[model samples]
Target: MAKKTTQATPKAAENEQQSATAQKPHILPDRVWLVLARRAYEEPLRQVGTVEADDIELARVYARSIYDEFAWVEMALVPRETLVTVIEA
Candidate 1:
């Protein structure tokens, strides 16, 4: 007696793939945002702190609300994920 093996058809394989993909958890982009602020005109922007949000607008809101204690002349938020490091410590 010999063992028998079965192979899935192309459509069945595709359906299985699709089902597996659907069953996997949907991963969302949660990023740490770097907050920078300048106190006055001609002042260099400095990193104040970081904020966490899923998108830029939400990050901006979070940064402003969290760091609003200072009378900053300007403020900006950049997703830390987009930054490239030139030097490593």
Candidate 2:
């Protein structure tokens, strides 16, 4: 006859999660960066996607890696905070 073993209970898992979170300090939320790119010289730059990053350099790296679907002629990153609201939506 084979021996039977018991699986971990939900309470035990919850305790482990609590301890893990307690050990680490709270972190600030990442800033949102708007990605804009233009495929051709004649075309206007359009918003392709967005990325969350700690700084501009990291944001640039993330934008390039995640939005590599196009061979854009020009690419730019604008911080979400800098944009002005011309029209309320």
Candidate 3:
């Protein structure tokens, strides 16, 4: 006696293919942003920290939320890729 094998129907195979396609990894829009802030007008902007966000507005909000403990007079966020490196250590 031979063992019986069950085969998937056409619809089931299509659904399986769709599910496999859907299960593929999706790339997120996040980018590394450098946060700059200054305590006072006299002080220069300093690289306080970094944040990951999809866009500049979100990065700004995230940076402020994370680093707002200080009484900073000015704050700015720029994508890390935009920074021109003069020297590397």
Candidate 4:
């Protein structure tokens, strides 16, 4: 009789997952967020914004809030002014 090897073992699967996670891009603590273009839509699917997030969870929270707050196109959390940078040496 011959023994067969499985396609994936528990340890192998875990290691694969770990490696996949490590391969993902590292998010920073803060990011430049576009303030506009997220409040014009009426449906949840329509509202979309871009921002730098520390993690995927934070990005999700921000997207949800933007959708809910702009349900009626009244309340907006995004800023009006363009991005500003000050350099000090």
Candidate 5:
């Protein structure tokens, strides 16, 4: 009689996958800022005015630093490759 080989059960495979996933660092998604801004906005819009702040460039700098800080965990990432479309009727 020939001996049969057994593969790892699904549960074992799943556990191995989970452990591997836990070892990686977190990835900051592109929408991360939008989400952060939304949460920030939750606190009443302070200094509401027509004046614009030149913070976009500053934010880009911060984002670059943040990206290097967390470059592992995988998640839905959005790249700023196109202009945001505003649909107004």
Candidate 6:
């Protein structure tokens, strides 16, 4: 007895490739922005949340919209990639 093999049709193969591509995670530049907020001028800025955006404008909008739980007097967005880990515990 011989083993049987089946071949996929061109259309079905294309569809399978497309579905595989869709299922794979997209490769995008590091766009994670760390959201920092301060309750008062004297208070130190604390990490509140993070947002992913392609640009600073979008990051600003996302940070404001997503982290609206508190009425922070000052809010800032810093690119996570630029942050240098001084000490890692």
Top candidate on lDDT is 2
In terms of TM-score, which candidate is strongest? 2
Candidate 3 deviation (Cα RMSD): 7.1
TM-score versus the correct structure, for each prediction: 0.64, 0.70, 0.65, 0.26, 0.27, 0.67
**Per-residue lDDT over 3-52 for candidate 1, one digit per residue giving the tens place of the 0 to 100 score:** 89888999999999999999885877578998999999899999999998
Question: Candidate 6, clashing residue pairs?
Answer: none
Per-residue accuracy of model 4 over 1-89 as CA lDDT, tens digit each: 68986688899999999999998867544654443433445534232456555454665567557555444463223431354568833
lDDT of 6 by residue, 1-89 (tens): 89898899999999999999998868665489999999898999999989999889989989999999878999999988898989986
Worst 10 residues of 6 by lDDT: 23-32
Q: Which portions of model 6 show Cα errors greater than 4 Å?
A: 1-30
Better of 3 and 4 by lDDT: 3
Error of 1 at 64 (Å): 0.9
Q: Write the per-residue lDDT of candidate 3 for residues 3-56, one digit (tens) a residue.
A: 999999999999999999898847675799989999999999999999999877
Clashing pairs in 5: 25-73
The C-alpha RMSD of each candidate to the native structure, in angstroms, is 8.3, 7.4, 7.1, 13.0, 15.5, 4.2
Model 3 residue pairs with clashes: none
Candidate 2 structure quality by residue, lDDT tens digits, 35-72: 99999999999999999997899999999999999899
Model 4 TM-score is 0.26
> What is residue 10's positional error in candidate 1, in angstroms?
48
Q: Give me the runs in candidate 5 sitting further than 4 Å from their true place.
A: 27-89
RMSD of 5: 15.5
Point out the worst 10-residue segment of candidate 1 by lDDT: 23-32
- CA lDDT of 18 in candidate 3? 94
